[model samples]
Target: MRAALALLLLVAAGTAGAQMYKWKDAKGLTHYSDTPPPASARQAEVKNFNSAPGADLPALLAEVARSHPVVLYTAADCAACAEGRALLQARGIPYSEKTVSTADDHAVLKKAGSPGQLPLLLVGQNKQIGFETATWDGLLSSAGYPASSALPPGYRHPPVGSAAPRRPSAAERERQAQEAARAAAEEAARGKRPPPPANAPPDFQF
Candidate 1:
């Protein structure tokens, strides 16, 4: 009888230890949280605890950058994506932001896993889909990435149109024309012109 009582007592203690928590949010809305909320908050019932992604921000970015090509797969007009772009630009880090919105972007989305989520940050040969602040910060840091908000010196976006300037200044044009004329005159003086047709036969030798 004593052994059975001890066993029952152990089961009761275990159940008590696994109690659910409840709390209220600032909105006066009562909520449940696994971890301690602010002063006004209380613990919530965590149906099942999950191992959250925890990473060292800086180290994560360094490692992630090396193995993964930073691809910010974001949709157009996405505030997070825009902020993300600004963040990357500040760091002066090079990245290909595939803005998806139109049909073309949709095609890219299909390949990347459409019907998913936006602001999809990829790195370290692995693509992390979703909006997890901790995970992203860790990945960026691991990749040795500069602070996302740091600006690169002398950064300028190339203007649209021809990459090389097509219009030359008047001075430049005249200079080139003069050079060409001088070169032609030198060729003529060198007597490098072809001979008359009468002396142009293949059988004729110089």
Candidate 2:
């Protein structure tokens, strides 16, 4: 009887150690379960039940955030953008900011269905082109964010980044420069002129 009890306890301990998997499908749907995600699932993450807490975010807030991530798009020298950011901060909504400052950034914004609009807010699939306190509040509430601040003390949102793809690191930039220099030297050796910039007008001489 003692040996049988010990075996049952071991089985229980093993069951308790099962990890959870969180992932997004090709359709952009998020899923969470103890079982492993499908091979096709993107951004899959295994969460250990016994892991120490990092951010200590509230359970409800974390759940809501996982289901409906928030993103805000802003531009420099825009008053509305500042106000929108302030509103989100006041509400303790964890969100990432995308700054639209370059042509590439603007192109990405347009692709996201914004016609070069500033202060755009995205809550899951919902889009708000402009900032309005009531509208923004409604969207957050609809997305299951708490009405009042639930963010932990000292918690800070992610830093703002450009809407364009991430810029290469310094090492990558140096490597590219060296490659360009080598190519230029090779072209000069062959008595050939390097191509002009892509944006150069057809009539513009190299």
Candidate 3:
């Protein structure tokens, strides 16, 4: 038993001495070899594991987001928009969605360089007008996002547009107050009860 154990330890020591070389060619493809790579190859720092190109994908992707934020422009009742959203969510991409519901929203979309297309995805200044899984995947891969779902379970993204309460701007608040007053006056002219304030909380009687 002692002799067999000694032989196993010798084999293990030999295996540990085996050298592996890693390098990248001019075209930026990673190569791994047991033999030394060519002098022209860009030798990568030796690591225990075979490191692929973009081995530090998560950190690189985070840096990309800081420099080139992702934005998804969507609209309600749009199937394609839902699919595009699902794709981003499945890839664990952090993005902000701008809903094209109001005229102002449409204007914002246009200024983002979309040609009135639905499901427009913005990667930094780069814009994708329509949702195509292959194309979107390729772009996301190039941006260094992981190619698979990495989201934690029950990870709720910010509620879809209109589902979350939004703070109104000062100008919007004033405009809403004016509209409310106009509505109340119109209701009074009809001899009906005036409506509650626009921002009033619901009063439920059970």
Best by lDDT: 2
In order, candidate lDDTs are 0.49, 0.73, 0.62
- For 1-206, candidate 1 gives per-residue lDDT tens digits of 33345444543433332212355676778764222234455332222111123321244433333334455677656787676666656665444455565665555555555454677665534466766656766777776666554323433321111111135689976875676666656756657655657857776544
What tens-digit string does per-residue lDDT give for candidate 3 at 30-101? 986433345467744332221233322245544665444566889889999999999998888756566887
| Quality of model 2 by C-alpha lDDT | 0.73
Ranked by TM-score, top first: 2, 3, 1
> Which lDDT tens digits does candidate 2 get at residues 81-180?
9999999999998777789988999997887668988888987667899889999999999999988899887566655667774567999768756766
All candidates: TM-score: 0.39, 0.59, 0.49
Candidate with best TM-score: 2
Candidate 1 global lDDT: 0.49
**In terms of TM-score, which candidate is stronger, 1 or 2?**
2
Error of 2 at 173 (Å): 8.6
| Model 3: lDDT of residue 18 | 29
- For model 2 the local lDDT of residue 50 reads 30
**What's the CA error at residue 28 for candidate 1, in Å?**
63
Report each candidate's C-alpha RMSD, comma-separated, in the order given: 30.5, 21.2, 26.8
